[model samples]
Target: CQPGFFKASASGEMCEPCPAHTERLGSGALLCPCTDGFYRAPNDPPTGPCSGLPSAPRDLVATTTQLSAGKLLLSWTPPEDTGGRTDITYSVECRRCEGAACQPCGEKIRYEPASAGLTDTKVSVSELDAHLNYTFTVEAHSGVTQFAAQGTPRADRPPSTSALTTSLHYTDPPKVTSMRVDERTSNSLSLSWAVSPRPRAQPRPIRYELTYRKKDDNLDVTMYTVLILEKSSVQINDLAPGTAYLFRVQALSSEGTPGGSSMEDEYETLPEAHLTQNNTAVIFGAAVGGAAMLFIVVVVLLVRKRRRNSHTRQGPEDAYFSSSEQLKPLKTYVDPHTYEDPNTAVLKFASEIHPSHITKQKVIGAGEFGEVYRGILKAPGRKEVAVAIKTLKPGYSEKQRQDFLSEASIMGQFSHQNIIRLEGVVTKFKHAMIVTEYMENGALDKYLRDHDGEMSSFQLVGMLRGIAAGMKYLSDMSYVHRDLAARNILVNNNLECKVSDFGLSRVLEDDPEGTYTTSGGKIPIRWTAPEAIAYRKFTSASDVWSFGIVMWEVMAFGERPYWDMSNHEVMKAINEAFRLPAPMDCPSAVYQLMLQCWLQDRSKRPRFPDIVSLLDKLLRSPDSLKTIADFDPRVSIRLPSTSGSDGSPFRSVSEWLESIKMSQYSENFTCAGVVTMDQVLQMKNEDIKNIGVRLPGHLKRIAYSILGLKDQTSTLSVFAV
Candidate 1:
């Protein structure tokens, strides 16, 4: 016998086709067995009378009714077929449908008629979300008995009827019961609300619409805005100080329908004079008047006193007295020229110490200016303390000497635990030297490299937190450290990090961009922000960008930024929107913060204080560090080759533009002041025309060249790996 067909009995001489609902697995001389959804009938023919299963449930229907606020009533009909059996039961199951997939309705869903059975055809599902669609399935089953002679069992076989499926949608909007002011400030107020109490079956509002206005203002003056909040509280800002306002909130369903509004509440913004501005103004007025009167009296007295002294003054003495004065020994004085920028006003703030107080020990390191040495400083009746002395080299010009000592002037003003402290300077000596508190662990980069893979993520984060704290301190003082990197940070034996170098630091002025334009300097290309590199616009945000690169360095054990790429290449890559990849095995959270810092728009980057807070949160929750970081090496490493594989074409954007005889626009393509190669590559034909490339021939050349460059980039991508 072939599959699906078999003999009726062992005594049969020939094989016969299997009856309905019967199947055989292989060619054999045995009778077929009853398949699923089928049964054997009593007193059947020798050939076999396997009856097919009854049809699935029919006339299936579902209806939903609004029970009350946030509650819904659902009803369904039973299947029409019972498989010729009276003993039957139905099981109901429900799941939420997100898109095409069905997910189990979690704790938010509840079922009425706790256990769905054959007699209980209708089931009420509560706690349904108004924003979601739910699918419910009902299966019907029958129990039948089989005889041994027939070789069929009657245990509950497959459901004689197919499972019925239906969906329910609840669109009831949520009701907001109460609203109140939680807090108020001079310019802002925080409002919170409570939703009306209802069963979990009721759907919650997706958003809240807040309408507010001055208490005495008319409805026309009211301001309205929507708030999408996961919680019940929201802070409203830009309110007039010392003003009274009335607020009302209404809930919005997922369908964008607004429900009833809550009762209005009154709140008064804190007065600007709450800090005793009136009293302070009166006091200041009185002080100014008194000081003016005193100044007049003092001026009159000085005038009279000078007149009297002038009249009482004696005439010049004779030759005898003049000769005696001239004969007197002249006192020796130190020359001001021996000191660096002695005429500069900043020198007045630097404390000059005697060279005898500092005993130079061993040469510690070398810097751009000169060599640094470990030394001991002895104070009167105090213990000798270790210090680091930064000394200027010999054969230096007056300007070089001043530049070397300028760091002392900058450091002397800062006094923070995270900032390196400056001791006194030894300008009186032959070689000018600056002394600072010594750090045992030297530079942060070297320290991290030496201890790679030894410190936990918490420890690394702690170090970053300290660095950010120091940067935050600098930012608060309106100061920007143009050069911020791991090498500039000094680490102590206790693993505390402090910002040290101030060679390129500058005080920010009042500017909307928070930028300090420099005329000339050697910029740190790899660590500089795009605006700073292109326009010399240095701001605290640019420093934040460099700090991000430093973060990568710390996490990667002082790895060189951009690998072995040249500075020009790094700048080009950054302009093309290519960011550094996360270090191997770096935590996802830390790398995410690094990417945030490297945002193209500096304003979007987090401030130093925000960085400190984020690091603190990460440290507090160490488990977050377990998240694996992802990086696409191909995108990050797709750098434009200096020499094309075909041959040497253009080494720089200027060269490329010059090749097309558009040398007049060379300055436009340089990374200084304006346009860059990356920007040129992304420019459309319209952009080229707008940039004064009016000649069709020139425009065609530029467009075709850009297209060729894009093609070359695509080809390079294949070999990037």
Candidate 2:
């Protein structure tokens, strides 16, 4: 072995104790193996007895430096000696303060071995208190014994303070980042900023003071418009478009101290032409590409004449459509102007109406607004007439009453058979009561449930056709029923379905075709279209989407689509384009039509006219609806065809012979040649007597099966008349 180093034996040797911090493992007469945490220097004498790890550091000097985000980084070197051994491990320790007789630093200190190149050792201490003094020490150990390194015991350091302050000052001045028109009529532009770095000592929240100047004049008279206290964003209004302006920003410290002015970012106010859709070019590209393109083309042509007429006629409609979109708030706050109870407002409207010819009766239905009652009146000398009275609850404001009146006015415009009739309104009462035609069966959901699936596929198709006709009619009148669902559709005793509840409906006479939140508020998101849910932006396409859900409800006998899903989960599913399954007894073609309406791409959805035509076709072929029921998704359809003529069950012996004997052969089967048992029963008595034709029981059974009318519950029998 080397002069003073040797292995004790083949067995693992126990380390021999040396002075203070020295250690070495030994076997037999050989010296204990040098312990870890210390290294023997090459300059040490070869014959020297193993000594305590040459003053393995008990304390290390490190100064904490502030990095980004107010963090203190501590770095130090490894212990000097490995107790006269090559194998060594070093550890680092820290404390709150460094002074003589300072106790072992608490658990705050962390230790790591110097294995990889210790070349320039560095370690970071994160999440330190800002601008606070800290003392750190490094302790080195050789095996079980620990020693201190020769270094200054006090490592006085503090976290770096950010140069950024909370007050607004300018060595230079704050400048605008970019400027673009939001609403041309509103003349509003939103500005944003890149916050400056905050000092560790005083972390500052970013605030903005948006100032503006007219482009034509060069003056320091920059008018301060808005003071945004704790945000990087601000919206300024009352500025003329196509005007040049300058802007500047200053950072502020947490203590409300202003930092030196950042270099002013010079930006000119963009003319009305510069506003990308929703003030975001990226979101516009993703969500509103088509709408943007169409709008851009139209605005370019309209811009020249726009200055002549300052009073923008399109502003209300545009604002209504745009305002309903799902705008994410930059920060959370409680808005004071919240929606009020619509039903109470409607009732108060009823109390105000002092009608000369008013009539009320038994309540037919109860809605959010109030109750609907069946009423009749025989004015002076006129014949008695049936009317539905809708009385609102009390506590509605005048604005709510007017809004209800406006909704009633729109509902009054409809006169289609499938649309519920609205006669007139009594606004003088404390609450308003709208008169209309009454339906005996109430809502479609209740109507269908009462029928016990007794309505044949044909009848159901007819009902759907009626609903589609009403929708088409409304579309023609430029009206969209924001809440189109089975619950809002009433059915008369004749089983005729009529669309009702104009509380959430809108007449796009002077408005655009989009969804709007009424004074009542938004409808349940479960039935709303994806776009409407995402942005509160509604269109005829969105109405079509809701109608598709209604169709599913009707066919499913009122089972909700994707039942029991929370709004957030439903949104995730919808954004992923998950759709409701086709209901039992729903014809593939009809279901396909509904799916077309529910297409994720709103533009690809079908118009009401197309939906009407498709429903009509399905109605004509009632058998198609039955055919749809036979389709099982879990298994492939293996329906046997009865079209072939090979003397099999698929073919009738008589029809096969007739086809074979025909001199002019044809492979196609004519609808005329095909006969059902019902046709045979319709034969004239004299012809039947002359022919003496009698159908055997088995033949009758076969005929019934062929006709697709074989019922498991009913036994077929010949009538003896």
Candidate 3:
């Protein structure tokens, strides 16, 4: 209260107290009172304590100078006047542009408030266009009052041109002049055309587009569209023939003009004879019939001219088989190789060994061609030996019989540990059983699985070397085991491996240069090369590829190739440049060798000779077999015993109780493999008591220190739930 006058006018805001030195002389004073520190004249107006100047912020700063992610941030110190007045709270204001012209900007994105005393000075804004520039300002406040001074505004920016563009601009449809689909043995078709000459003055920057439509579909869907720059040819493959197609092409220039002198064409694919049942039969029949008719007519003409050529021939050794009893075996030998030649003579010779001498045992196995049996052979002056007899199936047609004999003749030419041997034939029943040295273990996969992991790396290397040796022998003989796989490999008790199953195996009847058509089955796609899969063409290289997969099976303890993937998916992954990872137990060098065998281009693949050399080098290196031996499969974790409330026999009492509570327990806890000092401390004293186990006194003291427990505690209440 001012000292100018006594307290009065309680309903009014005018000061009544007057200054100690000055007093109001009139009852009707314009101003109420004066303070002691200042003098007021009689004519002067009275004033109360001056409001302390609102403190200016001592520290104002931007949180992030290079603001990004569509927002800006700022922070500052509160005013110092907060000591006498209520504490100052800060307010951050943001503008899109710089200077005072950028006034109070509305909340662009979101504003966060401080629950504690508002010394907070940070602010952010979003929803602004990317790359747009923005400005910000901050001020302090006390209750409803704001400070007189405003802080200098800070500005920031975000990146410009932020949206992604996906497509490129180009010229239009291509024109096709001629379309020719070849029905050659290859799966691919080559397409060619002649490009029209551009105008003499200017070539009018042009591009070509080629589109194909499936003939089976009536909807306007383009199966393929490609743009070419002046090229007049392309090759299309990976198509199912007999699927008709419609092709269209157009030309477009820089000016976007369409349809110049280009023409559209359409064609139907040749129905695939190999893929159709009746077509295959008819085509095969035609080829055989034509050859047979030509042979018969030539025979008749030769018979008629026999008397006239008697003086020119003059030899009984060259006589026909019908007139000669000793000609049978020769005919059998020559029939498959010379069956198509009209002028060639064939004779069959009966082997002197009687069928009764071959004592057949029980049937051992059966496949597409025949069943195999264990048999005893009574060879002269030699001990009775066990052999495998392969006999032809009952329902085989004459053509199939011819093909079988053809395969037998080819197998007869190959003599190696890797190939099955043909001891003799039983032609009386129109059956043939190949008698080979009997193997105790039927296949390599079954043998390895039975032995568990007993076989060491050296033994496996020996087996692989034996296989490579046999393959090398066959390769030298110009024979290919097209069906090389673990299932086809036999292992003797000595663990010596041998390749068998020569029914699909072949001899290069030609000079290994000519191509022959084979009757297709569901090829062993798991081991086949991509070329063989796509084109049905098998070569020595393809056989090598199959052998590599077989090698993986052996090294991996017979895991199936491409396991768990469908055939289609396997093919897709392979075409996309994916190769199988080496099996877990396979050495890296061995895996590298297998990878070399699986090279996509057949020409780049290793030959059997090179494989033999590489395998030999690996076999000689003792360190190459250094795979970790701890991966034994028989040492599987012992699951918690479900038998009784008692602890497991595999674990200690504490571990058994822990296992009962669904915690992990190691069977080797007491053994050197699992016992450790750290684990001993974690075990409680009560648990140790329950297990009738105890640590050393010093160790116990240390454990007590770690657990923060007295040494005399009776229960584990410290860890109780």
Candidate 4:
């Protein structure tokens, strides 16, 4: 009942001898008999104390080749037991045998290459008598047993032995001469190679190492396989269409020697299937015959219809068509470059004014392209007039120079009053310049910041109305201002706002959505529509999204759109269906328009013309401005300082005013008896003005700042609880 021994009586506590090449210890062991390489010698009773010299190695094997005429390769496993020792060595012994008797072939029995010894399980024996029949024997040796004899020590025990006899000849592995792609489809190919002619010999098994990879791929991504083939062909499936692949083949003989690899060959898969040339020709002929018959019938019908309508009375529809072409759907605008002679027609649109007639004054501002300067332009019949001269900076490449001039070409075609007028260009000068009507005030964002709440809601809405009018005009001409933002708009001394920047504008062709697919460019995240930013789709609808942000800018008096958030964060928030909260004290109606412009579905957003009408309506009804929403100042305006003077939260009116950059009004607050932070936080717009903060901008700033402090206090109290 031991692990390595069994008893004839089932379930009885008796042990019997283990099977051959297997052994076990004492009885009652649960596991089965140990296999070869783990067994020990059996005891006298064949059940207990099973430990001794190792058993003979099992599964002895040998092979020979004709290529090495006098050589025979031998390999075998180690013995089943080492007598409880680990250091085991193997030796290959050979003899020249006649019938039954044999004589040892000593010294002449040399392992291959004359370096391998008994330590190696595999050996190649050479220099043998090729005329004599040979027998090869392998013996396993367990070095230096630990046990000592009780009396006289017995002679060193003979090691375990296993033997095999072979007198076979070796043959060279076949050489693969050339490999090629035999056949190919869109996604699969078959490969075949020719083998060099060889002398006839006994049939032997052969294998091929097939390696393949995509052309230009690194070795790390290369794949290979070993195929035991009866023929010299293989089919590889699931290949990528129109992709090139490299293949190599090497032949391995039964002796495990690999021959030289065939030359690397490249092949490309066939392209996807399509209509054949004959089918296309047939379709073309059918379309031409159908079109000819339809044209003849239409000509005859038109002739008959004209005769029938000639006697009929003219209707109002006829009068409508006779008035002007403007009333009809206008033909799509085309880029001037598309004209046959662009040089002549392009010059007709933009005049080339000489630099000598323009006087450079001083630098007014800097722009992405170059610098802006206020200058005087002197024309033949025109008196000196102020103009903004945008001059290209030095060290500009030819491409940059072309982009600089493109804006002038776009502006020249625009004529709306709300659109910035391009007077002429000074391209002949060392620095190319674009001359346009100058605005006393600069960018709309900066103007809003400087005049925060100085202007009433009506005046701010008017500026927005002007911008919408200009955008509507551009939309009518099939133009898309890709980089529309408050910074691109200009304000004049008369409070007039005009759309200015045209560097990124494009005259779209006849597209249903007015969408212009761009490859890639720097996108303004906070101002860009979600779809445009994610997909590089620039359309009039995307421009509406940007205009929504612009509306927020005007209403918030130039606060950063997504306060303190990185471009990546803004993109993530917008993707998650989050929109910017209403700006501080922003009119509910105006904020509603901004939200409409920011609809996730671009088609749902209103067009520029519709926006203009809505703003005009809101402007007419002044009472609508009173409907304000509860604004989340944290997301709109900059957060107020948590720590006031003396490194603590604001506890008094002076400290709260100082935190909001209104330290100048601190004295006014003290004189108005607003001595505590609570009193200041509870104050309203009129109450702030009564406290001597007369400027609408200052009062509004104070009110919002107080609201922010109140929110902060409530947040702190929640956490305190």
Candidate 5:
């Protein structure tokens, strides 16, 4: 007899099978036992299945230990009613309170002192704030952080809140004064400040904090904080080259009162190293491995200044139309040998509009640096057209102001329908703003999600073609968009998709930024190519790989790439030759193109021109999508954590998919609302395709499995509940 069956009589020829939720191990048993986390009553039948869940742990006790002021210790005994199971795990939640209204204590605020698989009853928690109250709740759970914060799914086990008010108190903030810049380097700054009337006199101690902001901002517009325990002077390193920055120090008291110094002078960060990742690196007339490539031309950006997302542009400058460049597009592309000031280039090409020309409406969105508004742009000689105006946030330093408008320097040069058009900019007035055409549909990812299942595959392919066309244009002009994801692609009400956001865009020029770190500086990992991620190699090929991810996003109706996998997991999987599975209902040809884009060798990847041509070919021939692409089991033998079904841990729909080596369709099943075994059994050939299972082999495999499972179970009762 198998584990589910048992011997009922002393000399019986065959064994009887166990009832549901009951099992017999090692055979020859007279009576079957109840399953784990289940029970049997005294008068119950010997073969009856256990059907009860485990009860809550016993006597949950919470205490604030004397080892630390904010540290909390929790201890609980075994549950009086364990439901006869030893396989029990516990999850905990901590909340900070202000009187009756207490919200969840964020992961950043409270320090968790237990592992995720906390089987132990006793846990030590280092608690949160000084004046605010806090509580801890322990419950039996399958996982942690479920309902730990807002937006998480509610757990089956109800949470109980019981907390004590904090005893810690604080006083006025210590005054920090005479903050000044002491020394400066290309990549570091030394600053010193004095704290007047320090908080040592009070019972609670005070600490000094340092922060700095770039004149030219990075992707993160906020100032970074560096904690200094009562120190007066400190050095802030890893600053960008050739940019300006301001530093500030604060003497923050225990009560979180900020005693900050005035913002420092805008000192120029010196240029020492030229470590930048440039995709268009042309070593024109330069001695190999020598210092011959830094020469600047009047209309070119030949200087390799070491800045991430460098505030530089290499253009075939309209040198002849210096005064009239903004009025008309340059007919001919010419690269002259002279580097003009980036500020002057903005003045020359980017039309500076008066602040009065733009009228602000409601706030539409935001950028890394400021609030974006949907507004009206009424130039002197042009008609009133709707536009998106980006204004500099208040309290911006001069350098930040420069970096914000510098985007216009690049946007002003491009003249393409698929690229976001720069209407003009206003840099001279007190209110600095960069204006562009309003995109009614906003980002492609969110738009696709909002309108999921509304667009046909043909229309989706058209959107991809438009993006490809824009990328081809950029590639032709020698610009590499390192961060080309669906989110960066904007769409208008006309459904025209345009490529926007050049923060990670690089100049394809002679001798690309010569210095780089191996970690692929600023290039997004999941969307980036393997070579680019491991070698910091930014090229048109890298952008192609990103384009493939965008295609997947569009096909999946904006599903997150790689599902819920982490960056490390994605990197490991890619390194192991694993690629993202095809999206449901994705055209076979389109998925093939995505695979081509994600090829291991950069040279083998299709060029943007080729991509656009391929997209055009597909658009011209609609039958290409009818032959949906399917996965081959032989191809996915190397997929992570996959094995034969002989000793599988799970036997559900997802489990069956994993057993058949087609678990990538788990998301497809979820999206199609196919969760239970009944749904899986009810699915037919057309039903599989309707759920986005485009892989022909996958469709056959699932169909076969459904039939096999239905036959084995007879009545869909075996492993179907």
Candidate 6:
């Protein structure tokens, strides 16, 4: 008797073929186990054919830099209905989706480190063209030989693995950084800019675009652009003398997609009198007198340098902008740790407020240490100002009280329009309170969501710019905001977003790498960086990652980061190199900045200053956001919607399968325990096959129906169908 045959004779003389869905491996067995993602219900008899559990390996998250070869990094999770088996592995497939046509990519496409039949759920694909989106499919396959004896009806057996798809959102190479006028003559200027560092693996060419236009409000100036390759700076040989011109530089991809640009700056070419060449005669006449003057000027410069060196005890903020002292206003910060007593530190920065001056209105929010209220703070001779008041709960321990007041000590040390102002602290009263300027519009995230569609792309980017400005100020202060997020940003009626909620902020003093290590409290998994989450290293880089999430929230109109993924899953995916996909219709340039903020290497992430600059450029040139980030971030793109109109019962995967006349496989879905539309949204061909679905036509129909539901819900993986 063969492995698929069984003996059904009292005398053991006759061997019969095994029934459908069952297999006998030893050539002559009484019965067979389920095969190919098949599993019988607990009550089913041993003699019956096995039922199948539907499953498919899901490769949902993707990352790319829009490299010349279009490298794509993909990550997936184990299939849910592993058919109750632990021997599951995955395989990958590539499909090129562009301009209304999505077809399987052939051998011409390349997959780094091998493309198929692997245990590790990550893969990198290369050799694809940049600036275009592509689709990918990952399937879950159980050990074929290990389950060789198990069988199902040849036509009904589901494929071992399913296809999981998602969108790949990326941008062109980074824009030029540190752009400035190197030399400006009466009729010419040598414009220079630096390109941000790129990975060695970056095969694409980074082209610098120098755009210039006369700064004139009276007439529309003709915008001139110079495309430069293999160089960071270019000399614009021709310009009107004494003309004030606006200049900006940007890096372009091979496909001509521009990332963010440099801050639009203006510099007037030196007047005609300053131009050189024929001025040698005049110079020679003055040479005799100029020598003495030059000598005196040199001596004065040396004396000033000596004086500056003698008083070189400036704060970290000075060192940050030392090369360009006028770039930022000088602000002094007295570290709270300097004071021997916490109370002394708190009082040094902020004055104590009398309880009578504070009138509580109503509760607005709660935190770990206290309840917050929107209230009034009235100082003598000043008008009553609305402010947010935080009160220490009555039952809080002395330790809790100190921890709560510690924030006041920190906030009071800073002064910036984007930074929340610390009004005053009330410690003498029974309930100690911290007062702050009230943000009429409330938290940025909720506020954006409340008015999602009402904001334009420019307006939204402005809000992000304000947040970045605040973060820049905080970063310059050598402070690490461990829990930066849209929720931590407060929006005022004027739509100005300021950094607030300093509960998780700490000073990273003297850390060469600008990092702070701590045993610490809870980390916001979704908003935190990989290094910060795993190694407890909180740094400005980590804050940048959170800021990227905040950017997503702002672009998505306050959509939650890593939607529908749990904390554990979010960490795992992030660790696996998966990042949050671009928001729907997000501007390509804006997404590019967000991608830089989320670089896995903490040191590689851009600084807040650079981020602020990028946003500034985008705001100056609103046309930069015209090109949208393109990707089918929702579920499968091929499936059709079966769920009825608005606020329907939310169709389950089984019902959709039934609607498509594929109800024969509903039992497989039931066996797989797939209930929601989201679960089915990610199901691939192999997943449907593994669940007792066989036959090309059936799989195709089901696959199309499943993927077409990409827009059916807001909960599915951004890359799945």
Task: Report the number of the highest-TM-score candidate.
Answer: 4
In model 2, which range of ten residues has the least summed lDDT?
A: 159-168
Q: Residue 551 CA error for candidate 3 (Å)? A: 0.8
Candidate 4 ranges beyond 4 A from true positions: 1-348, 505-519, 632-692, 713-721
Candidate 5 backbone overlaps, count? 17
Compose the digit string of candidate 3's lDDT tens values, residues 1-721.
4334544445566555543434365654545443222233233334332122234555555443111123334455556554234545655545553333544345444343322234654543333433223554455554323211221112221111111111112222334455554442334555666555443335445565555655555332213434454555666676567665555455655533334334445555555664446987889988988999999999999987886677576552233112322211110112235446311211131132357778988998775567778889887776788887767788887655655555555555444445655565555454654556788788897776555445555556667777877776665433556677888789875456887766543332222222233466456667788888788767667888888888877875665566545566567877887666665455667778788888887767777778888887765564776753332111111122234354213224345324222122333245423254345546665644444334342233223332431221321221111
lDDT of 5 by residue, 407-519 (tens): 78767756666899988988888888989999999999999877766676877998899899888777655566777889889999757799988642232112223213344
lDDT of 4 at 678: 69
For model 1, residues 117-173, the per-residue Cα lDDT tens digits are 645555555555655566666655444323321443434544433334444445445
Each candidate's number of clashing pairs is: 8, 67, 24, 8, 17, 29
Error of 5 at 313 (Å): 34
- Per-model C-alpha RMSD: 26.4, 34.3, 31.6, 38.0, 26.1, 22.5
Candidate 2 overall lDDT versus native: 0.52
TM-score of 4: 0.48
* lDDT of each residue in 349-410, candidate 6, tens digit only: 77799999989999998766678999998999889999999988889877677778888988
Q: Sorted on lDDT, highest at the top, how do the candidates line up?
A: 4, 6, 1, 5, 3, 2
lDDT per model vs. reference: 0.67, 0.52, 0.53, 0.70, 0.66, 0.70
How high is the lDDT of residue 666 in model 1? Answer: 70
lDDT of candidate 5 vs native?
0.66
lDDT of each residue in 1-721, candidate 2, tens digit only? 3333454444565433343333433423344433433323445433334444434332344443322223343454444444455444444444443233434434433322222223334544433433344554344444323222332122321111111111111122123344333322336566666654443434333555444444345222223232445666666677776665455555544333234443434344456664554647766666677888889999987985675464465463444343221221111111112225544433422223235665776877665566778888545565667788877678876665556565565565455668887656776555677777778788887777555355555667777888988887776544667778887798876567898877642332221222234454555666788877766667667888988888877876665555544556566767776666676556677678777888887767877878888887775454567667333221111112234354132244344323212211122222334243344334343433333324332232223333332221121111000
The TM-scores, one per candidate, come to: 0.42, 0.38, 0.39, 0.48, 0.44, 0.46
Candidate 2 to truth, TM: 0.38
- Identify the runs in model 3 with alpha carbons over 4 angstroms from their true place: 1-353, 505-519, 627-721
